[model samples]
Target chain A: MAPVSLVSLGKAFGSIEAVRDIDLEIADNEFVVLVGPSGCGKSTTLRMIAGLETISRGELRIGETVVNHLSPGERDIAMVFQNYALYPHMNVAQNIAFGLRHRNLSRAEIKAAVLDAARLLDIEALLDRRPKALSGGQRQRVAMGRAIVRRPKVFLFDEPLSNLDAKLRAQMRIEIKRLHQRVPTTTIFVTHDQVEAMTMADRVVVMNNGVIEQVGTPLDVYNKPATRFVAEFIGSPSMNFFDGTLEAQGEDLVFRIGNGRALPVPRARGSAYSKHFGKRLTLGLRPEALSVSDASDFTIEVETKVVEPLGVETIVYFDLAGHPASVRAAPNRAPRAGETVPLSFDMTFMHLIDPEDGSVIPY
Target chain B: MVSRGGILANVATYAAAVLIAAFFLVPLTWLVSLALRTPQEIFFGASRFIPENPTLDNFGQVLRDRGFLNYLWNALKLSGLGALGSVIVAAPAAYAFSRFDFRGRGVMMMAILAVQMVSGLVILIPLYRYMGWLGLLETHVGVIAIYIAIGLPITVWLLKTAFDGVPIVLEEAAAIDGYGHFETFLRITLPLASPGMASALILNMILNWSQFLVPFIMLSRDAQWPISVAIYNYAGSTTASTTHLLAAACLITILPAILAFLLLQRAIVSALTAGAIKG
Candidate 1:
């Protein structure tokens, strides 16, 4: 396996830029996930690295050799496409052995390699069956098996599990993670699902609007997001944002919400928002960061609109002075609709962003 | 209860369908009856739906006396070669036009469509002079080449539609698995397009087989003539009467195309509908 690096890469189709100035370094034997919403250029960046797309500008290197001008075949990479594009005419064994046939291997070696990959993927009994005859999960294994037999320096996956049912997607996600653990190639996976990125990545690169938003470990991004987009996108039920003003109150800075509720700012955030006093800012709080308690230092009275019972936990949807907000609470203590609930804010996890530019205020 | 207008509409639909079917089948049925009638009956009898005395004498006479077998062979050779040659040349060009974005792709596609729009008869003089200058004027090669040129524009258009139906993901998978663009075309794209290619070949063969004007203008020698030109000779020759000329030669000339269509009907239907419901 080889480490790959892309420097200032960009791709444009006429006047529209699909990807812009992306620079990333993927270390050898690391599992990196590129996560973003649709049209955010995560897939485009991966295709550029795979050489399936032309780089409008910048350079790509694989282990010290520039590969921008090389074709996908010469770049020594294998890609598992979103649709699992198995050749409809070929059976499982034939599909797995196709890439090896062009190599200088003998028939026996090719057969051994295919059998080994099939066995690794636990698809040994499916070797004789065509792709159409297999289930979706079986077809996914075959797609992976086809890539494994080539044993390239890098493996690129473009939302390979998006077509499967939920249960099968979870199963195949584990299967792909386990396969990477076994082979340990430098792998780059692209997905619009942040859960997949959080669960499977050694390093997750969050992208938005054709640019990299943040790159860090899963916990690093969750606990300390560099931008409001990352903070909002990385969690379920999304982080809630309240437009407010940062002001000095008795020698301490506090964010005053619209209903005259004010929460003291954390000390770590003071340096970031020091110059933004008397200016508009956005306060981001994750659903888990807000707890339901009777006695707390700061509380926001919210009228519950809806309650969703999720067995272990319940999501309480309510209006915080007419602004929408949701809180995660114990299922047994979940509040009823139209009931007023006192929500205690966890200021330690509070995030502050500049309302004008949507950039996170450093602290 | 159903309305009177709805019942009348149903009756009218059935009547229209039957009328269209009869319109297509009547000429073929008449041709068959004419082929079976004797020369005397055809000349003297009333114009009837059925023959008074059916016989195989016209078929036998044409086969034995008129060198019909040689003409049939010439037509088959020319049409078969022309269809195969046109498909082989057009398939690659069609693939390029369908898949690639080159500098003059739109202009090139428009040029092909423009070629199809021009009538072959209007270019007869220029084509004839070009063939004469190349010393291919009276040969089967000259006729076959002209047929290929005439059939190419539409053949490319048909095959290009076929190639465009194949998903780009399949080709990209092949490319990442070490196949080049041409290799991917040969391995993935062509197999998916087999039905369309077969349909295009069948269509072009029918067009070239029944072609009359180009061969009529290009070839001067009887020995090198295709069935179309040979049938024209029967129309002018004194040995065969008009009734015999129409019955025997027409039936013989149409048999191969009918057989080809019968063999490829299923593929043709599927090829026509393959791109209708793509995912």
Candidate 2:
């Protein structure tokens, strides 16, 4: 078990840069998930850490060794690729024991290690089958078994569950978390799915456009995002942004919108936006924060455009003076599509984004 | 489930196929008929298409007096070693061509193609001079060398296509599993490309066995002649007719080709998709 550190990492393919200036420290026995959309350089960063890709200009240290010049075998990292690149000619036992073939171990030791991995992954019955004969989920388990038998210093997974169906993906996500708990190896998993990051990561690193937007626990990133990109990207039915200008009237700050509505800013962090009075900024509000409150400081009247009743909560989508917005309300109190109702924001949980640069003006 | 039009079309297809099969089968039947008859029957047309008397005496004359056994051994050694040596030498070069990234890769492949595209007769005089300087004019090794050179370009291209079809991830997985590049290639990629390797070996053997020009240009000794050249010796003489010995030797030569086709036709079919459709 050892920590890995990457400092000022950058990668380029000729003139086009893929990843730029990334620095991250993964502690020993910690599970970190890199979450982003496609082309965000998340997989490239994981490959660089796994020693599969050459480091363009950076220093990468694993445990105590600077591993920029090391091969993947020298780095002691096991990677489970997205497609499960199993040797088609080898059976399950051979696939699991392949990593130990060159190890200075006896036959009995290799057999025992393979048996242990099969037991842990519950693939004992499948030890003799080929990959093409196994189901998708079984193949994934075999892939994990191959990685875990080696018990490398670091485990890297590149979207291992993306090939599974929905129910199986959820089940394997929990199994992967349990495996991490049991083995406690420093693991780095990369995926474009945010739900997997939220459910499985000890810490989540959100990336966009080849840059790290924020790195924190799932709840912290969901609650207090540090940028407009993070604020919009971290939630399902993403946050709504409305163009508004700030006005400091008397001793309070208010947001003036085009629909002749002025919202009172929460006074708990009014000083952060005090200097930006009369300046154009963007106001962000999550759908869950907007409930059906009759009397609230932040209120807007909207005619419902679409009502989605998902049993636990009903989401109502409507246009806010030509900008699309949504509200989460009790399912029993869900209004019809043609009805008009007033939605309220709790005001303290509102996100303020600077329009000049796509960063949040932290309160 | 059969429609009227579909049945008619299938009947037509079967008719066309049977006609094509008969077109190829007639010459074989005639050859067998020719080998079973005596030279007197062949010249006078006294025997029918079915011989009145079939005899092993023609095979005996071919084996005992016509040097059939020596020619068969010489041809087998030449063709077998030529094909085997070509595959062994071309595999690593093809692997390097497919997997590495360096300057002039495209140019090197194109250069190979250019050399293969050139007329073999254009280089004949120079090749003869080169062989003479090496004192390799009349040996089996010299003929084998020429056959391997003729087989190299096509064999390398075939094996390169197979190597390219294998995913690099398997090799990377092997590397992470503690095997080096040499071991990974031997244990992983080579086994996956077995069908292609088998196909290339068979194709090279066929190519080497059928070649006549290089043997004519290289070997001047009658004792070192391959079966193809020996067959010409019996048939191309001015005093000879289409003797029973030539027909017996020709029939004997077809056995090896038939055996090879029976054994390797599946390997060739599987080679078209090996390492390509699997993980």
Best by TM-score: 1
List candidate 1 segments past 4 Å from native.
Answer: A267-275, A295-297, B1-7, B43-48, B56-66, B237-246, B269-279
Worst 10 residues of 2 chain A by lDDT: A292-301
- For candidate 2, the clash count comes to 0
If you score just chain A, what TM-score does every candidate get?
Answer: 0.98, 0.97
Model 2 C-alpha lDDT per residue in residues B1-279, reported as the tens digit of each score: 999999999999999999999998877787777778877767744347888787778777777864678888888889999999899888998899889987998898888777788777998899999998999998888889988888888778878888887889899888888788898999999998777888999878877887787888899888898887888887886232556677788888766866787788887656645556654
Candidates' C-alpha lDDT: 0.88, 0.87
Q: Stretches of candidate 2 above 4 Å error?
A: A292-299, A306-311, A329-341, B1-26, B38-40, B44-66, B237-242, B269-279
lDDT of 2 at A295: 76
Model 1 lDDT per residue over B1-279, tens place: 879999999999999999999997887777778778877667643476587788888877877854677878888888889998899989989999999889999899889989999998898899888999999988888888888888899888889889997888999989888899888999999998877998988888888889888877877777767787788777676443467556767787787888877888777666656567764
